[model samples]
Target: MSELARRYALALYSVCPDEQTLEQTAHVLMDDTTLWQTLCSPAIQGQEKARVLARLPVLDGHGLLLNFYRLLAEKGRMTLLPEILEAFNEEVLRQKGMARCRLSCVRAPDAAELDKLRRALCRLHHKQDVIFEIRTDPSLLGGFTLEIEGVRYDKSVRGALSGLGRQLEERRMA
Candidate 1:
């Protein structure tokens, strides 16, 4: 995320400190393409965009968020909303003492297998909890790869084959 987005996220997260409101705001920003597009459009005047935001049901009880939308509109920074939301979510996870991991494999594991993996990852990383984002990648061939805190552990069949190929190429050159 850009520094600007992170700053905005930190400001919002600090003042609101409510996950449900932040989540609802994220949904409004992401799920409503028309609203998002209108907000981001240079053609729309700030007052018009404010009117649009004013009518949003999601912003009903969220005066701070409504003002935030106006500020973004006035500043013409609606384009930063997605990145801001991402950073905000990261802050939320940090506050909850949780870590996010990405698990890529050829197929998803069963419930028990997933639970075991979650426990193992938590113990390995010394985290209270881990939230997994699982992806099915057929090119992985068989095994899975785990990514945590920007570090990727590659145990996939495709990764092994590629490593072996590199070793063979190095021997040939030597």
Candidate 2:
């Protein structure tokens, strides 16, 4: 993220009350996949992108957030909306002392399993307020990986295989 983007995100994060609202706003901005596609389209010009962005109203935004979007659109910086939203979310999470845990599973875990995992994670992190955002990635083969903040617990089959491969290579060299 550029300094400008980070500044914008921080400004928004300061005003936004909760992650859900910020996430909703982000979803609205991201829902328009066509906008990004058009921006990347070879035939589109910068002026045209600005025009397109100008037409988009600030969804649920008041005061600062609204003004920021307008400024970005006016300056032809709309392409950075996703990045700004992501940065804003990170800032919000950090403020809440809630590290985001991204869990990718090969299949949807049962409710009981999810609860168990959540409890385990809460205990592991020693956090009274822990939040887990679960996702399913079939390509994981089996098991899953837990990403908390920047640290990763790679329990996925693919990760294990890669680790084993590395160990074998080291043994061969030694």
Candidate 3:
């Protein structure tokens, strides 16, 4: 993320630290490509952009966020909304003692299995909780590979086969 985006995120987060509000705002901004583009258009005057933002349905009850959007419009930084939202979300997760991880497996786990896996990973990593982004990779054949905090744990059949192949190659060469 750009330093500019981070700074904007920090400023907003400092004033109104409500995760739900920020998440809803992010969704509203992201779901409307036209609105995002319009706000970022240099041809549009700041006053027009601010008026457009002021009339948004999602921002109706979120005065602080509405004001923040208007500020961005006035400052010609509406192009950075995505990065600001990302940084804001990261800050929220960090403050909540939670972490995000990616899990790749042959199949997606059931709720019970996912909960168990989440708890296990939390224990292993000494985190309060973990949120997983799951993906099904048929190449794995079975089992899963988990990536968290820059560390990867490969427990898949493909990984096992690759490791065995490497060992065999090394022995043959030796």
In model 1, residue pairs whose N, Cα or C atoms come closer than 3 Å (at least 3 residues apart or on different chains), thus clashing, are none
lDDT of 3 by residue, 1-174 (tens): 798998998888889999788888767876788987888899999999999988889888889999998999999988888899878887787688888888999999999999999898889888898988999999999999999866899999999999999999999999
Write candidate 1's Cα lDDT for 1-174 as tens digits. Answer: 799998999999899878677777767776878878889999989888888888988889889999998899878898998888888888888788788999999999899988998898889878889899999999999999999866799999999999999999999999
Question: How good is model 1 by TM-score?
Answer: 0.83
The residue pairs in collision within model 3 are none
User: Relative to the true structure, how large is the alpha-carbon lDDT of every model?
Assistant: 0.87, 0.71, 0.88
Q: Where is the poorest 10-residue window by lDDT in model 1? A: 21-30
Model 2 misplaced regions, further than 4 Å: 1-7, 15-61
| Ranking of candidates on lDDT, top first | 3, 1, 2
Give residue 50's lDDT in candidate 2 (0 to 100): 52
Best by lDDT: 3
Report the lDDT tens digits of candidate 2 across residue range 1-174: 677787878877676655676566556666768765664455666666555545656544444555555566556676687788777777776776666688899987888997798778768776545567889998878999988756789889998899999999999999
Ranking by TM-score: 1, 3, 2
